[model samples]
Target chain A: MELLLTNLAHGFGVALSLQNISFALLGALIGTAIGVLPGIGPVATISLLLPITFGLPATTAIIMLAGIFYGAQYGGSTTAILLNLPGEVSSVVTTLEGYKMARNGRAGAALATAAIGSFFAGSVATVLVAASGPLLTQVALSFGPADYFSLMLLGLIIASVLAQGSVIKAIGMVVFGVALGLVGTDVQTGQQRFTFGIPELSDGIGFVPVAMGMFGIAEIILNLERPEARSVLTTKVGSLFLTREEFKRATPAVLRGTLVGSFLGILPGGGASLAAFGSYMMERKISKGRHLFGTGAIEGVAGPEAANNAAAQTSFIPLLTLGIPSNAVMALMVGALIIQGIQPGPRMVEAQPDLFWGLIASMWVGNLMLLVINLPLIGMWVALLKVPYKYLYPSILVFCSIGVYSLNNNVFDVYMTVLFAVFGYMCSKLKLEAAPLLIGFVLGPMMEEHLRRAMLLSRGDWGVFIQRPISATLLGIGAVALLAMALPNLRKGKEKAMAE
Target chain B: MRINHRDVVAGLFLVLLATIGLFLNMDHNLGTARRMGPGYMPWMVFLLQAGLGALVIFVSFGKRGERVEVVKPEGIDIVRIVSVLMFATAAGTLYLTQYGGVRADKVVTFTIMAGAIAAGAIALWIRSPETDGTMAAWTQGEFVAFVAAMVAGVLAWYFIRGAGGYFSQGYNAVGIGMLVGFLVLAIPPGWRYLGLICACMCIFGLFLEKLGFYLALIGTILLACLAERDHIRKPLGVLGLTAFLLVLCWFVFIRELDIRVNLWPT
Candidate 1:
């Protein structure tokens, strides 16, 4: 314990240095600015800024990148709350309740809850990282291909079953989303599946166009179609403060979210992506304010916000301990580290204690900086909603188009966005939820990869899913959920699914 | 007879999509369960899709068509096409091996090719006299905007023909661009607001490299702003917002981020 404290103190010393703090602050500022754009998410900002980090010292570079990652994520949730635009998968859950809160004039409360929840989760996750990095790495490395496949399968099932409509239609949407995701070059075979001979689609459809189209552009069309809905985004701004009751409700959810996120985030592949969705499902099931879920519940925002934040912090575990990049952002960190002549792994702790512990401490520092930066900025973000819809939509369209076009500098993506927007608008009229489709889209490709690899490993044994302990447990839970969903009389589980 | 219009339409749409999926997917190998090929998962998913869609249609039969659009009796031909296509393709994809003297992949491919052509012929012969208003969904202003978008896209395509990627596909991107414009007619609210923004994006995409960021921004913003009637009420606010947005974007995206875009026309 004393050694842990000493290491953490040394980390804080490195992170708090004058040079490091400025860079960290610069990263946060840039991340927030870009991330607040309609379609620019953290990954895009990080990749764009990655070249700039080449010149910095190894530890300082990692610190700034971490700062940018957190800042961009916070900015993402801000727009997801205020503008109903989720730039990525993690923030999609935030939109379900956060946008509703904004609609209910509680945008302030939702923003505060997210900022505070994220901070709390970050702090706890930082401590957890410092204390048991190696131990958790062992648990994470235990997961095999089957385990990952089963985990993602359970994720898709829960995402669809917990969606806010008929389970059948949601399943159809999920299935279709998977099909859309398959519309690129096959990773294993190098043969294209559904690209229809378009070379621009070899990398698959960019997620930004699909997400922004389905959420932001479609939203503008919907709001305009309603004659009385003009300027609905400019509803009365409520107090930025969470009420005592709200705080009391959010506290437990935050704690639970931190725990959920920390554990899930340690796993590789798409584990961190599941953090917010898992927490959202849990909140929908048993949070004290579960009844208020569809009406902008504070618990919904608090839990998922905390969970994703915690996941973001703990995802560094694989990179720091196992020399594995958990996601694209961490892979970039690995690249930065490789460029700096410092190899990441078990040796990293002993050989480069400054880099390891410093990165850990800076996660907490970055969270603190995000709170300081964003709390003052929430009022301004909500102020954006005050602009009349007529002027605002046009500006948003420009930013969104620019962001989408910038992905590959191809206009084909702009066309994809237009197509999805029309489809999304149709979905709204048809009573089909877009969330499950999105979840399926994000997870489908990963699940296919893992499932194929797992099948190859087990030589086509259908029993392999239940044969492994981890996958067995995951599939067990999924089976129970599916069975409950299937039995109409089972109001016990539908109590929450029906509420959504 | 009254029918549950929403469920029936949604169900038919899903089945149509699955049939298309099966056709496109049949060209790939469907290896056994243990050693799956690229087509295996898609074939299974498309089958599940057809089944789910059929279930939705079957379930809708239990409900009174409450305030729903009644299906014209003559349009039963379209329904027949949907159901037969669904069953035939799903069965062909699954039981491809049972067909003698053909490889599994070839069997599935031949079945889909044969089935799609047959279905097309049937649909043409049994032309349902329903609304058929997908083309009529376009208004004059929207049509003008779409044509302008197409002009911009085609001009850009011709000028940039030396480039690779979608250009190598011979105006496939332009066709894709037009597809989105037409898709506005496929859905609800009749393409007024959605089509305008979509057309604005198309124009922006076509001109951003050549005309530069500022001009494209102004052009697209102007097109999008026309979606609102009240924007003409306060043209100055619109103008000021456009000007302010240009400066803000220049500072934010260009100067601060060093995004690779020319601010002025080259």
Candidate 2:
């Protein structure tokens, strides 16, 4: 405890530095801007900015970039709340009540709750990061490939069951995502599997292109097809800042989301996004005002936004401790560190304690920065709705394209983004939830890796997944989730089969 | 009396692609000790995808006479979309031409892309206010403004890097130059240069200089502009200005306190 406090104090001192604060503020501002622009998500934004971090100290660079990551989530909510256009998977839930809130003239409250909830969650989660980093490392060490696979399976099943819509459709999307994830080079072998002789196919499909295309571009296309019923915000923009009653309602949800996000964020695949979705689902389940869920439920906006930010913040744990990137943003952070000649793993904390601790502390500062940036901007973001559409959609496309291209400096990604956007538009029209597909896409590669790794280690023993206790527990959870999903269908099927 | 063509097309495409994938991967191996072969996973995925495709196809065909409500696409919008595509393709071709001896900087490249896309959006906006309007404006104006501001901000950032000599002096020169450049390029020449002032204020704010005055000035201009338009009778303009100021202040005191800021350039 003494060591932790000392480290935190030292971190705070670093984060409080004038230079670091500036970077954090810049990151938050840029992040929010990117978030507001549909299709340009944090992953692409972070990747684009990765090169700039080469000049700063590791801690400052990370703090700034991290600000952008979570800030984008906050920004994304603006679009979702006002326009019903979610920039990324985590923001999908935000679109539910967020847009409705705008329609109901509660855009201010929705934006406020999200901003405050994210701040609360971020602050609380920072404490958790300080307190639980070591403990979570211990838990993470216990997870092997089988355990991880089972955990991902559980995540998939839970997400499917908890999603709003037909369970069958969710499952189908999840299955499709998983299958699509298999399109890259075979991990077990050195040979290309699904590449139709396209040189790019040899490396397999990258998630960035597919994700950007489906969620970002496809959304633009679909929006273009139909006249938007309203602007991003509705009603004459009022003070949309949270009222006292809203604060009271949102505070608990923020706390809950923070707790849920911190723990889940430690896991490697789709942690932040999944936590966001899960938090919203849980919030809906527990809320007394369930009917208000799909229509301007403040908790709906708060929980997911808070959870995503918290998860994005806490996800640094695995990357910092184990040198494993659970998501694309963390992966970019790893690249940034490598460019700065810093190695990522356990020794980083000891060798570069200042850098690590500074980063963690700066997260607190960054959260404050985001709140400061976003709170007053609530009305401004709401006003974005009044901007003539002629100038709006094109700018979104440009940002999305630029952001996507900057990810790898590859035009192929831009093409892929367009393709995915078309796919996403189609999915939205078909009522196919893209979240499951996104989760599946992230988990697919890891699943193959784990499967291959387990197979290799066991020398062909398929029972490894069952034999490991942690793995078995995760599988158990997956089984439970699957059973939960199947039970209703089975009940319905019994009568149908009887009728047949 | 109809089946969803979109679903049918998607299903068929999925099935076709997966089949081709499986056939191509029929013999690959990953060098695993167990020799599960690289093709193993791909085959599994292909089969699963094929199965799902079949399932979707079955549903599409099984539910005969079901009226599918799809968002309709007008012929003109499709033409506009194609034009955007043509423009993007042309831009790419021009970019390639630049590689083939045509000179282009990052600024030029970005400007061209932004301009082309904006022009396409404007054309669409004039034709379709309901469907393509909001998105068009967002893409062309606001997003472009944000990008240009960011680019200018980045240039100013370079100026802030040095303290006095070539590094420091050059920093200020470039920073000022960037702001001025944006003021000229981004601001509309029309509204008594109201857009130009906003661009300048944004640039000043980015440089951590005395930005409050410009913020106020921009606010006043915006307010005047809004006031002139009777139909756009909302205090949102004022509210937005205030928000901008508030955000600027927050960035100053909280984020960049070390910088000496006068709040008025002149």
Candidate 3:
């Protein structure tokens, strides 16, 4: 406990520096800005803003990125309440009760509940992450190459199973993504793999171009295809504060949400994506306001909002400890870290304590900053939403063009972006989820490195994976998971759970 | 016939990619399983991928295909755009052969060149047979705008930053720019707005070095605005947007990030 407090105190010292605070503010602001945009989600927003982080230090960059992530979630829930436009899957649940509350003339109350509940859950989860990060890192330190490979394989399998569409298609995308990642020169032998002798590709495909092209520009293409359909609420936002009775109804739900979110978010495959959905389901079944569901219950908004924020905070444990990205957004984070030349793993905590703790400390600071900035700016954000898609999309295009061009101070990367945009559009039409592909792209090399190292150490013995207890256990769990997902009844349940 | 069209096509695409990967990776040394070569991991991955692709195809037969919907762009002119794209592809091929530093394999390289040329030829005759051949005033206007802008961009880039020798980036920029424009037709006609915006990015990339920041910025914003009919009629708004972007890029790119792209043609 003492160590946790002191470590957190040091983290605060690093995060509270003027430069870091300013970046956090900027990330949150940008996060909210794009989050309020009608159709772009958190992944798209982060990918769009990633270019700006290229110039900052690794810690500051990650601090800002984290701020942007949760800020977008905050922004997404705002739209869920006012416009019934949940920017991502997690916030789709928010729209259910959140939109109803807005129609009940409680827009201000709903917004406040989301913000406060998020702040509370975020505060709790930050402590949980701070307390648990080192312990998990210590546990991860003993993992062998075989164990690491199995764990990553398990992660890939889980990511594919959780994907919304066909499991086989998702697995195919994962394989395809790994193949794409293997392009450029090989690290071990210095032999080129799939560059086709293109000099630019010899260094491997640029991460930013692929990410920006796949998520950002593709989102623009998808958005432009549809006629603009945002219906902004013109009703006055009456009060920012909740009534005592409403607060009383929300307190217990917030507690329950924080508990549900923190626990699930630690699961390797379970990230923030399902936390809001899970909490909403729980609240509907058991909360005091269960009867009020579908009619704008405060519990519906409060529980899910808290759960979502807590889950977002705790999901970093996998990335920080096991070096496994739990979702596409986390995959982008790994890409950013790699670009900065810092390999993410158990070693990160010891080697870069400043980065490690500062990020943890900044999570709380960012949540607080969101609350401070959002309540007063609620009117401004809503008004900003009134900006038409025509103006909005062109500006994003120019940004993407310039941002990509600035990467190498040339146009080659921009060309890559164009290619990926077309490919991304095609993928959506084919109903393939890009998330698994992205996760695979980021983790593929690491998995291969571990696999090769383990094989070399074990003298080509494939049984080494099963021989190691941790590796065997993880692979066993993965096999069970794959089998369970194949079950007819379970597959039906999975489709329903992931349908949103 | 009852199989899911999306799954079959997606599966076939994956298979094609995996086969290509297998073929390309076949030459690399595949060492013993204990000490793997650079090709070993990729080779295994491709095999797994191809198997998965086959499985995807096989599974599709069990499910009914959903009718895929394609939305038409409300009133966008596509003929002038295709003509310009064809002209640029032919011209870009000439420039690439003359200057590109392509150390890529001859067979693969020439195949791409030939493909681009053939695609350009087909695009040259892309007008729908049902439509009358008489050109609209707007088509003529769009044709002039696109050709003039591209010409100015190429000339400006050539005179200014085109000093770099054999491996000039003009080749790569134009090559990738053609990729989206030519292949976009594979999707339904109504979905060509995607191609247009992609072309805008290509224009920006292709010209940023040659035309410099301000001119490149102006060309891209103007071209991008053409895609949305709502913004095209309002020239003042377009101009305002151009100006806004100019200053925004100046402040953000030049002042803030300190990226060294020039402001004007040297």
Top of the candidates by DockQ? 3
| CAPRI quality of model 1 | acceptable
Top model number, TM-score: 3
The prediction achieving the highest lDDT against the true structure is: 3
Clashes of 1: 0
RMSD of 3: 6.1
**lDDT of candidate 2 over B1-266, digit per residue (tens):** 44544454445545655655555554475354455676666667668778866766566655431224332322344655675656655665555565547554444444455544543443333222123333222233443453444345444544455546533532244445444444543442221122332232233323333344335334333423331233156557545644554565446432543223244553
Q: Could you give the candidate ranking by TM-score, starting with the highest? A: 3, 1, 2
lDDT of 1 at B74: 42
Docking quality level of the chain pair in candidate 3: acceptable
Using Cα atoms with residue i matched to residue i, what is each candidate's TM-score against the true structure? Answer: 0.67, 0.60, 0.88
Q: How many backbone clashes does candidate 2 have?
A: 43
Error of 3 at A368 (Å): 0.7
Local lDDT at A73 for model 1: 90
Best first by DockQ, ranked: 3, 1, 2
Q: Which ten residues in a row have the lowest lDDT in candidate 1 chain A?
A: A491-500
Query: In candidate 3, how many Å is residue B141 off?
Result: 21
- After superposing candidate 3, which stretches have Cα over 4 Å from the reference? B63-189
Question: Per-residue alpha-carbon lDDT of model 2 for A80-197, expressed as tens digits?
Answer: 7777877766787788887788788887778778887888888988887777766655576667766766766666676665554445455567777776777766654456655544
Q: Tens digit of lDDT per residue, candidate 1, span B1-266?
A: 55554565566666767887888887778887778888888888789888887876666666522223344434334554564465446445544544435555563456455554443333222212223343222244443443344344434444455566644453445644453544343233445676676777776775676679999899888877877888878898789989988997787667755667767786
